[model samples]
Target: MRAPLRSRPGPGAGHHQVLFFIAECVPFAIALVVLTIELTPAHVVYTGPLLVATPALAAVTMGPKGTLAALGVAVVVSVITATHNDAWGGQQVYTNLVALFLVGAASVVTSRAVQTRRESELNQVRRIAAAAQEVLLRPVPARLGPVRAASMYLAAETGAQIGGDLYDAVQTRYGVRMIVGDVRGKGLPAVRAAAVVLGAFREAVHYEDDLVEVISHCGEALRRDAALAGAGAAGDDAFREAFVTAVVAQIQEDATVELINRGHPPPLVIGEGSARCLTPAVPLPPLGLEEFIGGPPGRLESYPFAPGDRLLLHTDGVIEARDGDNTFFDLARAMEAMRGRTRQAFLEDLRDALLEHTKGSLADDVALIVVDRVDRSDPVRGR
Candidate 1:
């Protein structure tokens, strides 16, 4: 598993803060040097620009009041220096003071304008990101037939709420079908692949009766999208090694679930105060790489999904998340501890555990879906 990208807080702010602190000291030091050592106007003429620059720099890290304070000090110092040089009434003082005031005011205005534009751009980006996330990972219905479901996606990239990992669940004439998959890489390429698979699955779930056919539909969709990107934005090299590891599931009204694993992590079956693995008996190749298979792929694995049972399908991010000591997260241990948790609580706690193990950041994109077989007579759920 690839290690996820770790995020840092306020990187740009920290850098600016350091520069601002240093800038603050340099201007004051230069002014003190002029006030003590230099008496002639020619020797101190260089200090005018430095004094004006201080307020401009302050404008970036400080508000209007703070910037105004800096400007006041700079103007006062300029006047005092002019008086000491016996040039207070000359055109030199007027020219120097006017330049200082104009430049300082311009800096304040420029900083505020730049800051406002930056904030607007950030807001627009966030809005676009949220819309893309919704379209990519459509919200799962809380109830699908007799099942209770909840899903979560943890994106490894900084400020990215969605990534190559994708999950979707929908009710069909045949049954309730769901797919959880991960693209081979990260960034836009991976995201494009994920979008292809999701679009295929969402459409194929309605038309295809067999889960195997649905898997093929998703694979063909990936191949077509890859072909379109041929020698373009995404090259053959990316498509060559790029394949999606996926698991497609069909939950029958009879509480039986059929799983088709394609090089993805196995789902967990939690019920009766115990949790167990529901991995396919036969190994399967990942989607879009079945041509590499010499023979047949893995057979469909079925297991009884009784009332009150919960199914957890996840991407590699959760299992591969590492701690400070490089220890991998233990999913089985977490499931064992949360065997009887409600579907919603299980997903919430599971994410918390993954974050705790990884020190609040994951090494890769993660998508998790929890499916609960509803028990109409259950005491807690009945209320």
Candidate 2:
């Protein structure tokens, strides 16, 4: 059985706390050792390295705050050591204090420099990732055959360009094929899985003659890669869980849509003045979780998609998004607010609602795609 997903404290905050705690305790440990040893002249020789190491240690392990704290502790230790040894009356005390002060200052400066350098490198990485994400999931043109469209992809975590959730649309010989899915994990691994799914989908969308065959081909691709990498078991389980829920659709030339659901959140079809869930019958397993061949593919459900009708596909990140109070956002209410709005307006409202719902801190990445059919007689081909 799959483990239930839960929100946890940020790893970065936890790492900071642990580093601070360790740095704070180091000074006390040194003081205890100094007291245990008799106040001898030889002890002063050992104190020099400790004084230098304290601030340097903090700078390397923690940040500015930690380095400052370490410096303060070192000053206190120097004063106590000097007074105990009757060295305060001599110039040695002044020289030692000056040296310790310089060390602390250097540590502080070094820490800030290191922090700035790391931030710059991270920003560069984020930019590269964002650019790659754009290339992998390029913008879907406003029109796909008879459909007009718009989309939004929001990473739940700050400074993240893409996550596990993914969506793609392409015009194929069969029709305009689209997919929305979520991977089971996060970070680089999830991104890799998403890329695999998308890459296979793109190839199959053009070559495969049927939607089911396309899904099966993508499944085979994932399975082959898993087996070749000796990741068959883990990969199978990961894909099964990640994409355990997905929805695939093909828009026919006759303005009808045929869809397949695999334990995924049903999509919403907005028309006239209301939105309705396009629930599937005889739901199949998610693409990668087809462990065994089943009976013949189920019949595809059809819906009349007239000009101006809009269909929205989204990952669970939207509905499952939680706020500080841990309450889920009202997806239905958001959709209701989007009624009667243009495709662009609808997406804008949805994005605004998601931000408002999570107060700008969502725990899961969101990937949404909208397809709106344009009037057949309208001269505007791509808008």
Candidate 3:
């Protein structure tokens, strides 16, 4: 039996909140300690430096507002301590007060400037990521020939919208052809490879009648890209060892699905009340490593895909996610639980379940495409 997904807060949420509170309170806490020492008979020589540093410390955690508040507290403490020590009218006391004001104002301005620059940089990054997503992972249509399809992608790294994972669906002259794949590495290199494969796939699907030929075109494209990248970055071994695990599926008008999985997780098929994996008949090495296979690329394996059946194609990230106890996520069980949901809802809830299981921490990028075979005559369409 699979464990139910717990819709609780992220595991690190409370811990991060506690640490943030402590960091925010440190400046005020230091001021209180300094005041207590000044009031005592310890005769602390020079607390001016410590007092001057409080606003800067506050600026780091609380921005300009907290810096101003800390400046106020430091000013009040400095006055009270000076008066208590009977050093009120001395040049040293006046100099310390002036220094405090200067430091506080500087801290406030610097903090505000830094915050604005950071926000601007963040917005710029968002715009670039949005554009990259649009170009790299073109949206799968809601209706592709005889099947209704939806896709979702989640990048593993923070502030990233796309990564090594890739998927695309196209309605070609033959049928509705789709591909879901993952580059062997990550970051910009992986993205470049993914772009190459998708570009080849999109172009080849239109001309290549056979699914095998489409995959071959992607492999050729990846090899060419790797060779080009290797030439520019001399002695780089990433391109030499680069490979992509992929699966290409074609759904014809007769409701038959053909798949050529190359070292990737099998696609799942869900019927009215049953679901099963469409494992490849002869497993082949990933793209860019065809030399190791010793023969032609694997042939397309066909399976029954009746009307109203749902097909799930995904990268390994879906199953490789682990919980606090180090248990792997059960993809088939999750699909079973979310059986009756509408197309979009099913994908959304599936993502939520994955997040819940992993406590919002995934180790790798995830890309999934769920497709439903629908009759042309059916009045209802995918939403």
Q: After TM-score superposition, what is the CA distance of residue 272 in candidate 3 from its true location, in Å?
A: 2.9
Best lDDT among the predictions, by candidate number = 3
Better of 1 and 3 by TM-score: 3
For residues 1-383, write the lDDT of model 2, one tens digit per residue.
01112233433867877877876677557655654452664574556556656777778766888789878877777778777877778886687678878888998999999999999999999789868878776767777777777777777654566778778889887889998888777766677677887888889889887787776666667666555545455545544344435678899768678887766788887778677888887777765667643876545678767776778898888889887889998776788777777666677778777777777666777778888877656765433
CA lDDT of each candidate? 0.79, 0.73, 0.87
Report the lDDT of model 1 for residue 171: 91
Instruction: Give the TM-scores of the predictions, in the order they appear.
Output: 0.80, 0.80, 0.86
Candidate 2 clash pair list: 148-372, 184-242
Model 1 weakest lDDT span, ten residues long: 1-10
Candidate 1 displacement at residue 95 in angstroms: 4.0
* Order of models, best lDDT first: 3, 1, 2
RMSD of each: 5.0, 5.5, 4.7
For model 3 the TM-score comes to 0.86
Residue 132 CA error for candidate 1 (Å)?
Answer: 1.9
